[model samples]
Target: MTAAKHIELMSVEDYLAREELALEKSEYLGGYVYAMAGARNAHNLVATRLLVELSKRLEGGPCSAWNSDTKVRVRTNGYTYLYYPDASVVCDPNPGADVYHDRPVLVAEVLSPSTRRSDEGEKRIIYSQLPSMKLYLLLEQDECRVTVYRRTAEAFDLEAYSGLDSVIPLPELGIELPLEPLYRGIENA
Candidate 1:
């Protein structure tokens, strides 16, 4: 007979404490910590471009754009999840914790092959639980494509944009992001 493996879970306090001194970044979900993988050049380029654009557009506004180093806290189904999105915009910043943002108006993830499933499935579902989140973006690294989820009175509205000439209108934050600049210098993107 095959033996079942036992998984030891870490507490939220311990996880936070460890993260304070850890050399690398890891996401906390429930009671488990998942190590983050290093991003590729394409991923970095895409994420950086998005961050730059968001920062420029959000300047002098209530919302501020943050890089991947900023963690977002989401609580749902009796579990606390701390995710490091590729880029995030928070109009209402949490004053209690400097390391994480509890209320983010927009969250963006540059999709990669290694993390596509979780980003599209698990992360998407969990992020929706945040009442402050109004927009979610899934940007493709290898192509000029983006999947946008905008919150409505009833539910989230899904939209997809492709091609370099396409533009994404984010009226929630009063910003319009063009795909040409986002995928600039990215070959075949």
Candidate 2:
């Protein structure tokens, strides 16, 4: 559960073979595996809602929606192998070996207390390096907040939103998300 426990020498295949039955979330470090904690009900609920809405909207588009079970491999030269995101959308349908993509057009992470900082920090940094990544999104499990990053020629621009009626326009996928369906069953709902 600490820095020392994370091993950095296991091959991607070896890591997968060892922890295939893991009940909780597990991250594949360069060569070792680390157990990931569970997300709260709100976190999982929102992730489900977002995926549902995204799937419905992206049905006929070229992009495909991937739930968390997919593992994302961020190209690390030789430093590290993969880093998983909660949800992702890819323009390509024929992603090889990896179901989770490093070339994703868009990636979404549902925030939990333990991972909010990582999703915003280390994970964000790792994702930014992907050439095909266009938008990186953070979904709030504690509130109705959503932060989006769009790739521009010079840099990735940031757009943050809250409450209902704030539309998330995913141009590549030709879809827009309104807050209504995303925050469907919270206490305030």
Candidate 3:
């Protein structure tokens, strides 16, 4: 008979402390930690562009744009999930800790082939659960395509934008992102 392998889990506090001193970033889900994969050039470019645009438009405002290094903490009935989104905007920053933000007004993920499933499926569902989250963006790195989820009274409304001329209107943040600049310098996008 084959023996079953044992898996150990780390507490949230331990994970946070270790993550601070770790060389590479990792995401925490419940009691398990998963290593994060490095993003490609196109993914990096798209994330940077979105952050830059958001920062420019939100200068001196209450909200601030954060890079992927910052983690978003999601608490459910039975579990806690910490994810590092490509870019996130927080209007009401959490004063308790600098490591993670619990309330984010907007979160964006640059889609890659490897992360497409999680980004669109699990991440999307969990991110929408945040009461403060008003918008979610899924940006395509290899193409000028964006999937926007805007929060409505009852539920989230889905919108799609494609082509360089298309503009993503984020009334929640009072900013509009032009697709041309977002996909700029991305070869074959």
Candidate 4:
């Protein structure tokens, strides 16, 4: 007798329908529902740190900073996908009522050893599907380096900075963040 192979997962909507009353948040994608993973210590620290600064800078502004609790909806070929980045800033608020944001201007994820690949790879592609997104930022968990992806008329281009002396520029929001204080107190990070 041969072992049976598992069937592929369902779409984002189907997964959500099945787990209507579930406690944990789920990210819906093509035939898959990824249980929202709790961040590692370093992940939590960096995310919190970034949010604090960004929030302060964006206070009373048109842009709002949302934690990972917010889900970004990506629509492609009529398919809808949901992903939760560590932190995101959105100018639009019409994602849904009592739910996550749909159209975001900037999305940032702190890259860990586990999530580094996907956060920098697959998520980038999915995020590009959103026309509202202008910048996608990736923060390294073990270092003070940051990589920013900016969308241009032609294509997206990447710019990298290491340490606090470097500033992360968000021309879309007319803001530039000083990287030095964001990485303070990161252990071996």
Candidate 5:
């Protein structure tokens, strides 16, 4: 009989410290870290488009848009997790000394086949747990569909939009993001 081997998990502090020297980005969940996959062309396009539009709208305001490189820390069920959304908007003036932001009013994720399940499932649930999150956008890479989850007093409300004329309204930020830019350079398959 073979003896079972025990694997030790990395602490959050060590994980964060190691991440600074890592060549590629990875996410921290509980005591384990998971490597993040690279984004596809369509995914990058959508993220960039949204980021640009949001940046334009948030210029000189209390809020600002952050690209995927900016880490977002989320706390849920007594566990701490760090993630990098496709794009995020943070309205808080004080972001703390850590490299990650704890309060993001908006978080966007460009859907990919490999990550679709986790994005729509675990990520969704964890993101909703954020007290400051007002809107969550799930952009489709294969199509022009954009799903918006607006937070309400009770729960997050769902809204879906498709087509170039449709616009996503973020009442919290007072910005209306048009959908045309998101699918601008996506080649039809």
Candidate 6:
């Protein structure tokens, strides 16, 4: 029976402006902004290992790997979203001067207890919507496990690998990540 609440929806420009001054990174979806959670040691270690490996392998090539701070802009069904993956690889020769990357060939997320559901569900759906995404990796921080979603002609195929001997191959980037090295610094606590 009371008057409905009215709130001003934040535009992408407004979000970008706040991002510069804010202490922490946030994800913008449509008109809502959500603060990012801090990562634990295992999460950071895994993400760093992957980023370092990808960066080392992609050196001097047309492709480049980025850390989690790089934002990826996605527009799906009339809604604009800005998300930061744990690691991303962009193969574009001339990516325009934007604060976010829209043409990432690979996006990887190191799964934590706080982000598992959203990463596996919402993020999986959104990242796949991008035509430039060739591979999406979800890595477990507690164990040596990886879930890869590879894009085919019209859909994505799922693959899982575990143990220290498995190697994840990404033909798109002409590189392979061995499970041992990726999980080298992580420890169970």
lDDT of 6 by residue, 43-160 (tens): 8988998898899988988899988888988899999999999999998723555678988899999999899999999998998988899999999998899999999996999999
Candidate 4's displacement at residue 111, Å, is 0.5
TM-score of each: 0.95, 0.88, 0.94, 0.88, 0.93, 0.94
- Lowest lDDT 10-mer window, candidate 2? 93-102
Per-candidate Cα lDDT values, in order, are: 0.94, 0.80, 0.92, 0.83, 0.88, 0.90
Lowest lDDT block of 10, candidate 4? 92-101
Name every residue pair that clashes in candidate 6: none
Better of 1 and 5 by TM-score: 1
Could you give me the TM-score of model 5 versus the true structure?
Answer: 0.93
Q: Can you list the residue pairs that collide in candidate 4?
A: 9-31, 10-31, 142-189, 164-180
Best by lDDT: 1
Pitting candidate 5 against candidate 6, the one with the higher TM-score is 6
Better-scoring candidate (TM-score), 3 or 5: 3
Q: Candidate 3 at residue 32, lDDT?
A: 90
> Which digits, one per residue and each the tens of the lDDT, describe model 2 over residues 43-141?
888898888888888898778888888877776667665666778888764446544566788899998888889889888888888888889999888
Candidate 1 residues lying further than 4 Å off, grouped into runs, are 1-6
Candidate 3 matches the true fold with a TM-score of 0.94
> Which regions of candidate 5 deviate over 4 angstroms?
1-4, 93-97
How much RMSD separates candidate 5 from the native structure?
Answer: 1.7
Error of 4 at 62 (Å): 1.0
- Indicate whether candidate 2 or candidate 4 has the larger TM-score: 4
